[model samples]
Target: TDQVQEVLEAAGKVYTVLKIDEVSNLGAARIRVRSLLAALKDQADREAEAAADAAAEKRGCPAACIDLNNLDKLVPASFTEKADGVVAAAEVEQREGASTEFERVQFTEEMRDAGYTILAPQMAPYHFELLVPIFKRAGYNAVLLPSVDHGAVDAGLKYVNNDICYPSILVTGQIMEAVLSGKYDTDKLAVLITQTGGGCRATNYISLIRKALKSVGLGHIPVIAISFKDLGEDNPGFKITPKMLYQAIYALQYGDLLMMCLYRTRPYEVEPGSANRLFDYWMDACKHQLQRGVRQSEFRRTVRRIVEDFDTLPLAGEGTKPRVGVVGEILVKFHPTANNQIVDVIEREGCEAVVPGLIEFFLFGIAGGIFQQPIGKSKKSALGSRIGLAAVKKLRKPVNDALEKSARFHPPADIYELAEYAEEILSLCNSMGEGWLLTAEMVELIRSGCPNVVCTQPFACLPNHVVGKATIKELRRRYPESNIVAVDYDPGASEVNQLNRIKLMIAVAKANLAEKEAEARAARDAARDGAPEDPEPVAEAVEVETTEVAE
Candidate 1:
């Protein structure tokens, strides 16, 4: 154990030490040790190359010769020549004292008194819509921008690089369109966007928004970064107190519950708009409670009531619709506009949509920290990761309990359980945008009675490609009855093509449902005829796997 520890320490790595006595076979142990050494050598080579590239870049030589870290920077020198005109125009603007520094909006008492409205881009309708009032109760004037339309997408493409992820385009476009619409006074307006401050390009969205604003002559409007970390510390007035954080957490939980209930009840509601009307009612009520400052006990009681209200809705239809789960990149999975209103399309195709709750994403993010520690080389990171996992788990308990009380809703699996499930196929170190969480969500969906899934993602998102689309085969092998399809959404992707693919998935889902129903009928007949209560197990439903790539 001491020798192994020394070897690992020399390699600048860490591992759980096992005693030599624990190895039952010396030959097997030797082989495992050799494999570990090989992996360490590969890691060391990569690090040495990265260091060399950094040294070269520091000496003003292009890092591209040694490292392909950033694909965007790998363009040909001719691309730079082509950009000269744009650069020259920008330089002229710069000379005119055009501010390059991204302005941060401080949520001070003065700004609040002046009624400065903070505009946030809408991702999930119920979540964002309810979040507005939560911000208001916490003493900030906040509003979620309206749903993204064709105009928003067009406006987004105008300001943002089309090659970037679709979610960023829509978000940036929505804020830009809102500013350009001249609907609000520019002086009193500020745009709020979340910064993950991580490897994901989403952290740079604030910079993108600032540049877009500068280009559109809206740079005077402050851009506030909404992040839990110090990334958004430029605005000291936007204090996230413990109380405010508590309320916000509950708000998210409630939003997810409401969304779940809405999706479940909407398709079968006797009245066309009954579920929507109730949804609106709860939105208003939740907002009112937020304004009054809801207590923890009060929130718990309120959630139960909210669930009961939705449960009471008249669902007069057949109620046996094919259930389909939606999973993918966070924005594309939840944002209706980004995916061209896919949930509605699923319903139109005679299926009930089951969107995994937003809270699971939060849990997945927290649990990712715990997983990172085992493979991570840094001690500080490991410690911080452990602390973060514990803190989030503590916060998650109440929300998890509330979700459990909502009888009709399928409570999300524990974060550790999700990580365990994901580990069976994906490595925990595969932490990127969505990462292992995307794969885990698919597994969760299949486990939680929704076997048919639609994995929505931006066209060619590498992380999703690795962890999402790539994991489907393994998932199908494990859950043979599972039917999954990957749908790519992009600016040029046709709605007709997307829907046609989904229609086929729905066709398979209907057949699977029919088969299951037939098996159930057969079992019932056997029981009635005084035969064996347990009939022979039904054969596995044929899997329908398809990848719908956007043109």
Candidate 2:
């Protein structure tokens, strides 16, 4: 055991497990091993960064004053004047000699109190619309950038490297396009992006945006990166507080529940916008609840009300529409513009669009630490992850419970169960971009009576290309009735080609629905006539139709 441990240590591998029962007392050892690993990794980096790294370790977001007396004379009246909760604005000074980790941008501590117009690219519209309000309540003035146009893509192509995934291009494009459009004050502008800190190229998106900004002579604009990993002191003023994190989690739960309910009832509403009207009402209500700083009880009540409101949408004459599940890379799957309005496309084809909740993607990420337990550096880190996951699941209980109780809705609740399901096909440790989660979502979608699915992939996303498009045949083999179409989204991807593929999938789904209905009718008739129902003949007609659609 000592020799093995020595060998493992030499390889820079972590093994915290000894006796299994030792894991039972995490409170006794709450130290974070991941930080130690990060420190080691940082030290091994280029020696030129040594001084900057040392200064960063000791740096902190300073307590700053916010008053019109310190503010610029030309500052806008609404911004300079004190708001209900915020202090009067102060002049945010550009700091000298900050670590230009990305490029030549310097973000000072004063920006935290300055309330810069944070332009965050809209990923999930429903989620962000609900979420940004919570962020505002947490003291960050965040705005979800409106969907990008052709100009946005063109801007991205001109500024950002064209070789990356479609999402990066689109995201960069939106930010740059917004900046170039002169809609906001350039001096008081910032861009917010999430960094997963994973092996995927997405970890470097902040740097890409910074580089793009530098290329456009706007390098002074701070790129505020939202990362769970601690980026040392030479950074932006924005940081995630515990309260902010808590509020954000609830916001996401609301987003997921709302999204699930909206898609569930929208396609079947008697009035065209009945479901949307309900959604709009609930959105404001939930946003208010989050803004006012409610406890879990209020959140639970709000969820129940949300579900109840959506339930009242008065569904149209629906024997049943073929439900199409949309699962893919986080951005493209949720952002309508990114995937050429995929949910709308599915809805237009007379199908219920079932997008698995955003919370599930977050769960997959949180579970990654726990997934690494076997080879994890410290049992405490694994314990922390498990505890975090459990807490999130606990917070999510109300949303799931509300969803499950509703006659009109039922969304997936358990991440562990999902892991177990996905483990059948691929190892959970293979956590890259989407990785096993994509395959798992497709599986869950099919198993939950929604067999028709659309897997959206960014044209150049290698991880998704492997896990999503590559897993389709195997998924079909497992669930023979599943009608799946993988659509790739790129700056130059053909919408017509995508539509044709989707139309083909929908045709198959329609044929499958027809066969099932015929089988049911035949069963009823055979029972009345005291004869066994023959479903094979019923299947033949649909099969012929499917072949024609294929052709």
Candidate 3:
């Protein structure tokens, strides 16, 4: 009763709508209260929406007014403002059949044949490295932005709205810096931003990049939006054929397999550079395989070879180091620059960084749409997503089989498993930023023996805060042994502060591990002596805190 009371207090004050003792059965009490609470919550939400709509009517268009409000939150001045006569100026331009050139320029099919260079942001190092070759084989002069430098941040700060998320600034900066560097023909250079067509601001970054470039006198450089969605601006200039798509899929599988192998093997290798040297060799080999158009069987053979090489590498500390999982916004979670070399920092702190595979994120996206049929997802769209999900599973079998056969490697969890893990705390409908997948990764990591976790994100991402930081207390309650920390990266964030927080989490993890080992030894001794008595429960030392700490 005391423990139950403590848990209830930690969760927040619980109101008794229908007392369990007052009802005929416990299940009836829960059902009655659930229905009542849901009806009241819906009513409250509707009232709030109606009130917001009334206020927005006075302010202008509801959606635009909301956007304007978000933009002007930290300052008195409006971030998006037009001059008083701008509407009349637009009318005059309409009458004269001439207009100022703020219109978006499209990348036509001609640009592809002309050998225009395509610039994409660096998200996953291994995945993009593999993709560049796959892209070249299909004939696109592709270049992943080499790095996100300070100059890019300066450029982004100068043009991007102050209220935008930090990732948008970094990405915007990287793109603009590349355009201004004179590295490519401004007339023929094109930039690419992958969009999910989701509710996140990332879906609109294409326009933000375009606006920034136009402001810097580099408007002639076309900004291309790459996506599976049938958007009007989805690059008529470049096309991905069915064959090209399959090759890219294999690259994702190989890149994930290689990443898992490298992170697992590199920290403990007997030879200082052997793990990295072998990884580089395999990356080159896989690129060639894709270029040569390897069959599914051939791809499976390569996977086995890659695994055998990594597994056979001589290592000292196979399981000595505690595993720490990193989860959050995709770019910051995977990219070194965005998170300030967190994987390296984790290894340096005597822990192995266990990042979730990148492919699962794509799987989560496809799976989300399939499950959202009751909430506006079309039947046809849901069917397509189901087929895509199944196809991805079949496509993944080669790598899965190879990993399952390895002594040191293991395959990533299925999308359905991740969804089940997330369903405990949050609905799959909570899909934005990293969405429920963020919470799901922490659960998966804890269950997979990586109890210490670092959840990284840009400071101002709303959905991240909702799904990442907001769920920590509940997660702590559900899995008391887990030690998790939330790190938000911003332009002005301190790396030293971030390091100290990580060290604290690691300290707790080490203690937990020591306690677990001691318990195991005691259990072994008791088993040999006759009857074993119940052991005392181990109390978790780390407590949940909602404060933002930068990574």
Best by lDDT: 3
* Best candidate according to TM-score: 3
Model 2 global lDDT (CA atoms, 0 to 1): 0.79
Candidate 1, which segments miss by more than 4 Å at Cα?
A: 1-112, 316-319, 375-407, 531-551
| lDDT, candidate 2, 455-482, per-residue tens | 9999779989888998898888888888
lDDT of 1 by residue, 1-551 (tens): 32344455554564443236765678866777777788778876786577567767788766537444443377687886876677577545522323335555455667767888888988888777766776787778888888656777888889887867887788888999998888888889888888766577677788778878888777777788877456735665566678877677777877887888889999898989999999888888887887777787777677777777886788875459999999998888888788889889999988899988887776666555567776754667567766776775665555566567655665677777888889888898887778898898889888878899999988747778889899999999999989999999987789898898899999999999999999999988987986755334222111212222321
Spell out the clash pairs found in candidate 1. none
TM-scores for all candidates: the values are 0.74, 0.76, 0.77
Count clashes in each candidate, considering only residues at least 3 apart in sequence or on different chains: 0, 0, 0
State candidate 3's TM-score.
0.77
Residue 324 of model 3 has an lDDT of: 89
Once fitted onto the true fold, the runs of candidate 3 whose alpha carbons sit more than 4 angstroms away are 1-101, 147-150, 524-551
For the record, the alpha-carbon RMSD of candidate 1 to the native fold, in angstroms, is: 18.5
lDDT values of the candidates?
A: 0.78, 0.79, 0.81
Give per-residue lDDT, candidate 3, residue 490. 78
- Ten consecutive residues with minimal summed lDDT in candidate 1? 538-547
Task: Give per-residue lDDT, candidate 3, residue 548.
Answer: 27
RMSD of each: 18.5, 21.0, 18.7
What is the Å distance of residue 443 in model 3 from its true position? 0.8
| Model 2 alpha-carbon drift over 4 Å, by segment | 1-106, 233-236, 374-378, 528-551
